[model samples]
Target: MSSDDHGLLPAELAEAARPAIAEARGKPARDAARILAEAGLTGVCAQEDDGGMALGLSFALAIAEEAGAGQLRFPLLDQILLAQAFAGQDIAGRIAAGEALGVIGWEGARDGLLRLSDDCDCDVVLVPTGQGADLIERAGLTATPTPLLDPDAPQIWLDVGAARKIGSLSGEQMADLRRAGEALYGGFVTGAAANALALSSDYLAARVQFGRPLSSKQAVRHHLARMKLLLEMSRAALARSLARDELGNPRDTRPAFLGAVGNAIWTLEKAIHLHGGMGFTWEVPLHYSLRDIRKIETAFGAGRLARQVAQDFIRAA
Candidate 1:
């Protein structure tokens, strides 16, 4: 079914997702999966026959934004994309139903080690190959946790030498996944920036110094204005990336993704600064948002990505 046939708009999907995402925030991976799947979020883009809404990536992008805004730790974005990518497969149906969990290794397999974003509590994992990706069973793999960035949900390095490959995505499919991933991840970081902006604005408005609201200061106002500007630009970039070009072909999503990550990093850092000393402490939640965006930036190598975009432009020129 088409997105229009679902009788639900993207905004409505976001609204419906907020509460579920909020509830799933601190839950275990399996529990969070069930909560999201029961809410129909995990299958937002999967085929209808596979117990999904069969909506477009735009719908999934909306849900992704909510996941980001809520600071959810589960790999919801990967799950959603995998469900859609492996449509009609049993794994897809299981994922849509929340009976199975999957995670993707952002880095390609190197020296038998596959780097993952979150904990390895999943049933299977997608590891990047030379041209495509391999879906392999998670059992029999050694998971080495790296929790420096996010202690609660540490990154993991999986030894996949003994992994059993169950499925494979062709190069074309991998390309499609990358485009969709950029768009969804763009929305994800954009949501984090939005949340950080809200937090900063509210904090500054309430924070009084010398019997005056901090937000009333011109410097603070300027910072807030700049944050708002960047947030809107990120949103606009994401929206444009998801749209088809004039010739009815997909636009390159890397620019949007890169812009969103950079903007989010700047916004989060500024938000923390606006909080003064409180921002640096664990008492404030601003650090969580900052860490989340930074993790994505590091994972994707934002500087390298920006350089690649520039190189593409130069070649075209």
Candidate 2:
């Protein structure tokens, strides 16, 4: 098998998923989720016993990248990662059926509550703990949606109480889960960057300037080239990280995640610039991608988080 194929989806499965993903784009979030569920894309990495495809993380991440490209406002990552992290097989079954949504809830009690991830309108939230996770029901909590950078990306702070203990995750299990998260988010960044590049390239080609196509200019060509380079490098790094994970190498994944984030930011910015002011307007969707990247980057305390992961990896190594 080729290096790129390491733990990734088989060709048939990828092919089967593509059209469903395309059809889901621009649809309502829950509707899209159901569509994906119907297509069996939602359970790509879920266990076979749970009525899932029994595919691996690489397959999930590949689909996640496609989701990013389409910007199909659904909780694909949460379903694949957080739902699986949950203790009960019932939850897993619900996720595989696309009848439930899962989200990561922050640990600390903010005035007898915790804040969940953006766009988390779901039945349950998995609050990570020192041991495992606390599964909290949405009905038990009060959710107040907050304004965010990307309007499409909604968020909520919860007023919740004690949670039901599920089960504990071993250190190795926790590490693997985190790495899976990294792979999913990395795919998102890759898709966003790739989409931005495509958008900018298309705009430059069709747009006329100085009595000629903007893409005809050498400067524009160079900018496009740089964007392509950043995207490919980030993708390669992410692939390497995933490959390592598949090989049971326990290196920190933060570097690859951060690299993808950086590439997405740069490529999106370039795309906006190349669109020549039109990109900044809400009329165009390019700004939405930029906003999404920025929100995700800062929300995670990205730079500090990456550094800490690197240091931890170094010490362990």
Candidate 3:
């Protein structure tokens, strides 16, 4: 990736997101989605020919990180990945224009009724069925509200029928798209972990006990150091993966993305502990960060399943 593109795009997008974050806070999710769309944030990686900026994988990850930092309620990951996957398709233009949203059933979801993400008024759901992109119009599907770990991210059950075939993707291409999803998840976790760490650090510095701030204690300082270390390492790994993606080499990203996601989870989980009992409650955003990270970690595949996939990818490399 060009050095200029690496830092500049993310920096500008993150800065531009400040007001959008404020506007989205404590409001219905549509407001957040609208804010992101209005800022051109929703279409960061969309093909320019399809009315999108076509910002590439690196920018897409940056957008995820920035959006996650604010705990943005929009389904940005879904939108960006789907936009890129379905580029040149009819729905792509609508997705770029913010006129519609898209979701993907990436985990072995083919035909039949399936529950995708929560209700975002998705216009189409793309099921990666190995052969090609199968498009299920919202009209053809039924959505029922479902619970989710991240309140910002809603879920719904869709009674999918025979979907209209729109495009095709090879197995390798589908795997790459899945890897992109994981990377985007990592980026989000990185942002959330960083935010949580900052919150805990600030809390420790301000929280006084035994005539000294909690941060004065060596143990507390160690926690802060570890959190910082994890955040930096994850960022570095993601940067490397992005560099590879920039060079048109997308393989082996799964390992780095998984490693980053695992580190981010640990960092945020510890961040919660550092906050003590208060962290367990809704009074602080730590709970939200922790919840979201944990959920995203397991979304596509969890525990041994996720590990095996990563190992397989690494071994094949």
| Winner of 2 and 3 under TM-score | 2
Give candidate 1 regions above 4 Å deviation: 1-3
> Which whole-number lDDT from 0 to 100 does residue 45 have in model 1?
91
Q: Name the lDDT of candidate 1.
A: 0.87
lDDT of 2 by residue, 1-317 (tens): 12333455444565567788888876776777788888887776676677576666667777777777776566677777754554347887787778877666533344666665464467776665565555667665667766666666655667766555443456555667777777778788788888889988988999997899999999999999999999889877777777755666655667888899988999998888889879888887887777767766754568788779778878989
Question: Which clashing pairs does model 1 show?
Answer: none
Instruction: Report the C-alpha lDDT of model 1 over 188-257, residue by residue, as the tens digit.
Output: 9999989989989999999999999999999999999999999899888888898889998889999999
How high a TM-score does candidate 1 get?
0.97
Q: Model 3: what TM-score?
A: 0.86
Residue by residue across 1-317, what tens digits does model 3's lDDT show? Answer: 33334446666766776676657656654566566667776667777787767676777777778767777656778877777777888777777666777777655453565655454676777776745556667665566555656565555657666556555666766777777887787888898878888888899999999999999999999989988998898888887775655567755566666777788788878887888898788877777767666666655555765678768868989
The prediction achieving the highest TM-score against the true structure is 1
lDDT for every model? 0.87, 0.72, 0.72
Model 2 Cα shift for residue 269 (angstroms): 1.7
Sorted on TM-score, best first, the list reads 1, 2, 3
Error of 1 at 227 (Å): 0.8
Kindly state the number of residue pairs that clash in model 1: 0
